[model samples]
Target: MSARITLASGVTLNTQIDGPDGAPWLILSNSLGADQSMWDEQIAFLSASYKVLRYDTRGHGQSDVPNGPYTFDDLVGDVIGLMDALSIETAHFMGLSMGGMTGLGLALRHPDRITKVVCADGRADAPAPFVGMWDQRMAAVKEGGLEAIADGTLGSWLTEDWRAANPARTKSVRDMVTATNVDGYVACCKALQKLDYLKSLGDVKIPVLFVGGSEDVGASPETMGAMAAATPGGRYVEIANAAHVANINAPEAFNDAIKGFLGV
Candidate 1:
């Protein structure tokens, strides 16, 4: 089932629910430019054992596109508000890239709301280089729109061999990137630029699985491994031959890693 639900924040998010009724809850969040459909491959596999809830983050997909300069508080509050609206006291959370960062924020700010977190291809902190990269991206988008950055984003998301072999899929993702609301994209970039959750990672008491692609330069395996080591009872899994969007580039390996971590 799918519907547009307005949260307490007055931001309406496009949400979809799947799987058997009364199953354990599992929430799936998308990356910066992508939507809920990014996890289409994992739906069947995950829904079999979980009541999967997939939603487009604010400013992406069919969700509300509020004004610029969204904060991690806004991002995390959106999830908390969504769960409260649905009466979901707790659920397992999984996200990639921007979505992954959301999971980390939830673990820190709302630990009671999530049992475990699968943060794939996400970082805990935005260092000087990371801030510089977002600055460049935001500037490009402001000047030439999302089209200017689509190619580079896609190239970073998937490896050359994978993109070459999966031309149609690659084009679809490119389309999604270009279709994003420019203002929303830039606003999200602003949030990403200010990421600073690394120092507080040790405060996360729940189990967290940090999944990284071997070829993902944006969130390298080394960085994810360090993040995993920082969090209590955290685990790290490196998907071979995958890039930033490892779930799309290597669904099987990604699914296996999450399944093992989630035990479902």
Candidate 2:
């Protein structure tokens, strides 16, 4: 069920779709710099029972990055367009980091398309401290190229101990990051600069499951707890020994939690 889709915007999304039909559809979005393959572990287990859709965001993996300053609407449109192309009406949505922001955008603008939303290791509001990093990252990626951020993204994506213990997997993720195009990465960074969803968070009405990594420095559980408190029927869970990509860091526990949350 894996294929390449040409979106209306001319970006070719390299996607992998798995599992049964009419079952709960789980759409997996990636963190920054990586692509659809990052969700390999979750797709393996969930696809047997639930339809799992995973793809690269603009500027990453096999997806095409055409231009700059892409808005949240553009990202959401890509998701909707993919669903239209695939004939999907409603599906369970889940994302991490930038992907979480995408999910938030979809919930705010197109609530009817989502069955439930699960945002892991992401923020509803653009934290101020990250702005500085965003600026530096843009400059580095624009100047030194994608390789400049590969090692750093690798370390931040997972804990030091985890990376040391799983060198092969770590290397694979790092390679994905390093292979990214500089202009594409910088363009997404610009999109990040304009992203803020505090006003829109209150508009999302679907059941929301907030998952966080115990060691996530970017979007801490404390912040996710605050987000959960803001939204009714929001349940927050923290994955132990994980950082940003908890699904990759702690696959079994993460999958089990998602299965239970989605009731799959």
Candidate 3:
């Protein structure tokens, strides 16, 4: 069922809850430019056997996308608040890119609330050159909104071979990106620029699984490896031929890795 959780920020974020009620919960958080829909493939694979919760972040998907600049705490609070509203005391949390950063925030800020963490195609710290890219993206989104950046954004997300091999699915994903709100897009870009969680990760005692796609353009294997190395018991895994959206690009492998991690 679809639901809404009113956060301490006074903002109401939309979410969806499905799967077996008594089963362990697996929450999927999407990348910055995408929504919870990115995990549609994973949901199809995991929902029948396990309880699955997927939601749009503050400004992405069907959720509210407010004005400028949101903090990691803001994103983390959304997940925590959603769990509270759903009566979920603790959950196995997972995210990609921006969503992964939010997962890290929860692991650090509310350690007791996460059973384990799976960060796919994400980094603990933003790479040096990415700061410039984020600035350019924020400016472009602010000026022209999501449409102006949709094509290039999609271009960077999927490998050229995947786009060539799966034009239909690629087009569908691109359409979703174009449909996002410009204000929300820009706000997330600004948030991406200010992201830094090197210290926070040091305190993440929960088991963490870092999955990086060999073809990932967003966060490289080297970077994600560094992120995993930072966590106490974090381990890194690579999905062959998968890009930024590993769950979409490599659903079977993504599903297996996550299922094994959560043991559900």
Candidate 4:
């Protein structure tokens, strides 16, 4: 069953917990436009050895969509709050894209709370050159709503062959993108435009795993691997024939990489 927890910050998040209570905890955080279901494929595999926790980020899933211009601290705070409510002291964290960025922040701010970190398809900083692009995206979403960005996002999220062969799956992903709350999307876009957590990673003293899709146009393997190398105990893996949503595009490979890393 799904649980709704009202955070200390006055934000309510929709969360789901599975697996045995005595097992080690593992939290799966989704990308910008996805909800807890984004990690559906990995649940059975992961839950076998872990108390798996999945949640919808504030603006993306069934969670509250607060008005715009949120900060990294706010997002991180939400996770901390959820952990507190669940009485979890620490857990292995795996996040994709925006969620991965949140993991980075959580590691830096609450290092004691994260045992291992997996940052998949996430970036540490946003270049100034991309500011204009982000502004344009925000403008488009505001003007045309989520429909404005669905096609472009899907194009970057999956490979051409995958889209062609998996039309139904592709449509499902498209639905996720277009269903995103416009206010949340715009707010997240604004946050991404100013995000910069690279320099702070040096203090992150936890084992880190960086997963990237070979074909991901947004966050490539080279970039994510470099991020891994920069961290003290960082490792890297690449899933071939995958794109931004590598976990979904290449579930077996993605799960293998994670299972091997976690010794599951």
Candidate 5:
């Protein structure tokens, strides 16, 4: 089932719910330019054992795109508000890229609200280079819109071989990128530029599983492994031969790792 839920925060989010009526809740968050549909591949598989809830972030998909310069606090508050409105006290969360950073922030800020977190291809901190990269991206988007960065984003997301073999899927993802709201994309990028939660991982009391693609230069295995090492009892999983969007590039392997960690 799908609906547009208006949270107490005054933001309406596009959300979809699947699986049994009464089961453990698992929320899946998408990367920067994608929407809830990004998790289409894992919905059925995850729904078999858990009630899955996937939603578009504030600035993406069918969700409300408010004013720019959003912060991690705003992003995390969206999730908390959504859960509160739905009467969900706690739920498992899995996010990729921008979504992953939001997960880390959520766990750190509200450790009691998440049972476990699967942070895939996400960075905990935004260093100088990271901030500089996003600055360039934001400038490009402002100058030429999302079209200017769609190809580069796709290249970073999936490898050449994967894109060549999965033309249809690749096009679909590209369409998603091109269809995203430029203002929203830039706003989220601003939020990403201010990320600095790496050192705060130790404060996260919940279980966290850092998943990264072997070939993801943006969020390499070493980065995610370090994140896991920093967290008390956190674990890291590397999806071989995949890039940033590892779940889409290697769904089976990604599902196996997440399911194993979630014990579903």
Candidate 6:
């Protein structure tokens, strides 16, 4: 069932919980500009054995959009607050893009809260060139809105073959991107610009898995693999022919990788 949960910080996050209620807890966090629906595929596959929890981040889906210039701390706090509200002391977390970054922060600050973590297509830092690109996107959004970047985003998010073969899914992703709250999107962009969490990878002690898309320019497979190698107990996997959103573009492989990670 889906409902809204308000945190102590007064941020109300839209959440959906499914599967056997008594099962182990697992949290699915979505990418920037995406809501909980991004994990629909993963949820369906995992929920049978895991009590899955998926929530729209503070400003993305059915959640409230506060003012601009949010921080990773705010994002991390929201997830912890949600767990507390639901009386879950710990959970296995899986996140993509911005969501993955949040998992990193959560594992760092509240290591005990996460039993394991899967960071998919997540970058640990934003280089100057990427920051410049983000700045350009922010300016374009201010002028032409999310639509201005919709095509470009779609192009990067999925492989050409996947987009051509799955028009319905492509449309769904495009709509999700276009429907994103502008203020929230820009705030996240700014937060990403200031992110520098790569140096803290060694601090993460729990079992960690990093999944990357072979074709993802944003978070290349090599980079994700390097992150996994840096951690004390980390592993890496890459989905071939996948782009930025590997979980959607290559769900079968993604699910297999996740299941293997959990088995370890």
How does each model score on TM-score? 0.98, 0.95, 0.94, 0.97, 0.99, 0.98
For 21-48, candidate 5 gives per-residue lDDT tens digits of 8899999999999999899899889999
Off by over 4 Å in 4: none
Please give, for residues 1-264, the per-residue lDDT of candidate 4 as tens digits. 578888888889999998987999998898987888888889999989999999998888789988879888888888999999889999999999999999998888888998888888888888776678888888888899989989998888888898999899889888988888888887888777778888877788888888989998668787788788778888889999999999988899999888877778
lDDT of 6 by residue, 143-208 (tens): 888999999999999999999999999999999999998888999898889888889988987888
Clashes of each: 0, 0, 0, 0, 0, 0
Residue 30 of model 3 has an lDDT of 85
lDDT of predicted model 2? 0.82
Report how far residue 163 has shifted in candidate 4, in Å.
Answer: 1.3
lDDT of the structure predicted as candidate 4: 0.87
lDDT: worst 10-residue window of model 1: 255-264
lDDT of 2 by residue, 72-138 (tens): 6777888988888888898888998888888888877778998788888888776677777899998
Q: How many Å off is the CA of 149 in candidate 3?
A: 1.9
Per-residue lDDT over 1-264 for candidate 1, one digit per residue giving the tens place of the 0 to 100 score:
999999987999999999999999999999999999999989999999999999999999999999979988889899999999999999999999999999999999888889999999999998899999899888999899889999999999999999999999999999999989888898998899889999999999888999999999989999999999999988899999999999999999999888888877
Please give, for residues 159-237, the per-residue lDDT of candidate 3 as tens digits. 7787888899898899889878777777777778778897667788788889978888678888888888889988899
Candidate 5 TM-score, true structure as reference: 0.99
How does residue 88 of candidate 1 score in lDDT?
Answer: 98
As a TM-score, model 6 comes out at: 0.98
In candidate 4, clashing pairs total: 0
